[model samples]
Structure formats: C-alpha cells, structure tokens
Target: MEPEAKWNGSTEQVEFSRMSPRSQGFTKLPGQKTCEKSVLLFTFVLLISVVLWGTLLFLFLTRFKKIAQDVEKLQESCVYHNDSGIVTIIRRLQVDQWDLKNDVPQLSKAVNKLQEDQTTLKSKASQISQQVDRLQEDGTTFRSQVLNEKNTATQALEKLQEEIEKLWTEFQRANGSVCKNCPKDWQLFQKKCYFFGNEPKTWPQAKFACINLQGRLVSIKNKEEQAFLTQKANKKGSWIGLRDLDMEGEFIWMDGSPLNYSNWSPGEPNNQGQGEDCVAMRANNGRWNDAFCRGQQEGWICEKLATC
Candidate 1:
C-alpha cells in the first residue's frame, strides 16, 4: 500500500509506498530517524519535570497550614494561664488593702490616748512645781522669825545678868551697914548669927516666935553653918527653917529660898502620919526629919545675918 501526503499552510506532504524501494530507502535515512527519536524523548522529560514540581508545591502548602493551626492553639493556652495568674494577684492585693483600712481607726485611738496622758502628766508637774515654790517661801519666813526671836532672847538675858549683879552689890552694902555685930546671947559664925530657944513649942508657934525676933528659923547654908547650929542646940532636937508647908515633898526655907544643902538621917522626911510637914534636926546626929506641923513640940533655932 502507498500513503499520501498533503500540504497545509505552505507546508508540503509526500506519500510513500511501503512496497516501493525508493520510499523505503528515504524513510530509512539515519538523520531523519535520529531527529524523531530525540524529539519524543525531550517531550517526555518536560512533562515529568512539570508533574514533580506541582506535587512538591501542593505538599508544602498542606504542611504550612497545619503548622499555623498548632501555633494558634499554643497562643490561646498561654493567654488563658496568664489571665488566671493576674486574677489571683489582684484578689490578694484587694484583701491586704481591706485589712489596712480596718486597722487605721484603732491606731488613731491609741495615739489619742497617749496624747491625753501626756497632757495630764504635764499639768501635774506644773502643780507640784507651784507647791514646792510655796513651801520654800514659808520655810524661809519661819527661819527668819526664829532668828529674830533668838536675837531678842540673847539681848534680854544680857540685861537680866547686869540687873542681878547690881542687886548683889546693893545687898552687900546693906548687910555691912545694918549688921555690925551679933546681939548678946546669940552665937556668931561666918558673918551670920544664930539663937537657940530652950522652951519647947509647936512648929507653927516656933516659926512665929522666930519671926517676932526679927529672924527666920535657922537655914543651914553649908556644912559649916549646919555644924555650928547643931553644936549650939546642946543635945536637943530643934525645928529648922526647912519645911514643905506649901507642897508635899518640897522643903523650902522660911526665908522663901529653896533648901539647897541637906543633912537628912537615914530614911528621913517620910512625912509620917500624913500631917508631918515641918522639918526638924535630930540632936544625936544633927540629921533632919519631917514632923507634924502643930502636933509635935520641939525646941527652935533662929538665924540672922551678922552686923559689920
């Protein structure tokens, strides 16, 4: 059989017979066969390349989508955890603020109480200071008054001493002029005179007799005076000037002087019988005793200052 060739668009087509030796020889040329085979191989390689590139692009797109979804889920989880932590912190801060608000008033009250106590202490201190000042003033006034009184008493004592000295001088002068010598029958000793009465009499009667004789019952001034009187009595008890007529247990001389010197016998002046107020000198030992004023009768002795 023979194949016909046609031309289209300025291209020519040739028909070749399989049984013809010329057509077969032309188709079997090496250059033409090689050209056809090369064309086929190139087309197949390009198609394969295009398919491989398309498949790689599709796989890349699918992987990118999956990775984006996983990242979005992780971001959501982080946001939720962060929100929970923030809420807890905010609640704790709110509770602490409430506690502070509750404590404020009590702290203020304590401060006010301290201030009141301080004010009261200051007032008390002021009052004490004023009282101390007044006490100091009074103490100063008292000390001044005591000083004045002491000075006045010292001056008065000096004046009284001077007056006493003057009176003593006048008494010495009078005694020298009035008593030149003792009277007859009266014994003299140490510028004084004494008379012993032999007649026994009551104490009061003896006191009056001595007064009438211008003398007092014998007041023994010292041991010498006492010894002199005791010797003159001549072994007889005699009433002395010593008596407690004004007060019990207090013997004073009839001359209104205190009895300074005493020669009392053992257990004497006992004021026996409750009425023994007059004092007498016992004859045996010249010691004194208390006797009844009017009930006992005894001899008497009188004494007067001697004349110059």
Candidate 2:
C-alpha cells in the first residue's frame, strides 16, 4: 500500500508504514549519503593537524640540542675555574697591554743613555790616541838631543886628553931626565927613548939596523908622541915602524903593536906607484905618506924602552 501524505503548516509529512517498499528505501539512501560525507571531512582535517604537530616537535628537539652544545663550549673556553665566559681572559690581556705602554718611556730613556755613553767613550779613546802620538814625538826629539850632546862631549874630552898628554911630556923633558934614562944619543919621552938616524936606507934595511941596535922602528902612539917625533925629524922624510906589507892599506908596527893613531897628509898614503907599502913621515908637514918599500931611501927612527 502507498503511504498517505499530510500537509503540515510548513512541511510535507509521509507516514513510514504506509509507504511502498521501493519509496522507503529511496528516502533512506539520501540520509545515509549525507552522514558518510560528514565522516570523510572530519577524518581529512584530523590527519592534517597530526602532520603539523609532528614537524614542530622535530624542529624543537634539534634546536635544543644545538643550544646545549654551544653552552658546553663556552664553559671549556673560560680562563678561570669559576668563570663562565671569555670576560676574565679579556680583562687580563687589557692589563698586560697597559703595563707595556707604561714601560715604553723607561726603555727609550735607557737606550738613549747607552748611546750617550758610547759617544763619550769614543771621544776619550780618540784623545788617548792623540796623547800617545804626542808622547812618541817628544821621545824621538829627546833621544836626538841626547845623542848630539853625547857626541859633542866626546869630542871635547878627546881634545882635553891630548892637551894633558902634551903638558906631561913637556914637564918630563924640562926635568933633564932624558939623559939619565936613555942611551947616549937617544931622546926620552914617556918612559921610552927614540934615536933619529942620519943614514938614508931602504925601509927593510932601516928596520934591520934598528933591530941590531936592540930597538925597533918607531911606533908613535898618540898626538903628543907624534909631535915630539916630528920635531926630532926636523923636516926630514923618515921611516917609522908603519908598513902595510902583510895587507894593503892596513899598516902594522914591527913591534907587534896595533897602529891605533895615524896622521896621513891630505890625499897622501895613496899607494903611489902601486908598490908603496911602506909609510914615511913627510919632510914638509910631518904627515904620513906611503912610499916604495925597496926603491926609496929615507932616514929612520928607532924606539926602545928607557933604562928606568
């Protein structure tokens, strides 16, 4: 049977038992479709909210772990055990910088003082070098002056000695001691006697003649003896005991004495004729001349010690 329908004031009403089986089933299908649509919309919204919450939880955990690690590093970097951060280390570094700044002026002053001392030492060294040079110069001058004075004093002493010798010779002669101490025709001077011979003979012949008389040819010792002999020769060329027969230009006496004193005439003893090995006192000035040993004949003088 078909369900009867009634019109209410604002809606139409159908009785459920009076409806046919196909119409009731059709009316129930519309209500069921609406309920299914509501359930599907609610499930989609819940799933979107769950996804958003899961992403937010993951981000929060990662950020918290990174912040903990940064705090641990800051703890390790602290300078003091009680310190929490880098502030104490920074303050100590600032104090060291201030100390270095304060010491700069003192270091500069010390360096400047060293430079001044170096300059003073260099100046003193230069002055000392100059003083040493001056002293050397003064010493050289003093040595030269001393040497000159010594030479002058030596020459004066030689002259004075010659004069004294001449005076002593004169005193002996004036005392008439010549005849008492010497041979008959011999002249005495200085404890020795000299014989002036008149015979003209060669040098060798005169030497032998003097030896036969127990005397040798005269060997004049000093200026005083030389003067006396020259006066006795009386401007005659006479042979003395001087000869260079053993070696040229080195005269030696016959009595084996050294020929210490010599009175050579200017430009004489020139070994004239190349065979002049014998010496003769010049008749003109009593200076010495070298003559031929065997070719020239000359007067001779003999000398011997007096009888005391």
lDDT of each: 0.79, 0.80
Lowest summed lDDT over 10 consecutive residues: which window, candidate 1?
A: 1-10
Off by over 4 Å in 2: 1-180
Say what the RMSD of model 1 is. Answer: 26.2
Report the Cα lDDT for candidate 2: 0.80
* Candidate 1 TM-score versus the reference: 0.43
Clashing residue pairs, backbone N/CA/C < 3 A, model 1: 179-307, 179-308, 180-307, 180-308, 181-307
What's model 2's TM-score?
Answer: 0.41
Each prediction's RMSD to truth: 26.2, 20.0
lDDT string, candidate 1, 1-308, tens digits: 12333334224322332357876687678898889999999999999999999999999999999999999998888678876797678788899989989989998999999999999999999999999999999889999999989967854664465356446645877776544377887887876778888788888888788767766688887998888877778477888888897799998886556878899999987988898899888886789988887855457898776655
Please report the candidate that would top TM-score against the real structure. Answer: 1
Q: Residue 141 CA error for candidate 2 (Å)?
A: 64
Clashes of each: 5, 1
Clashing pairs in 2: 3-18
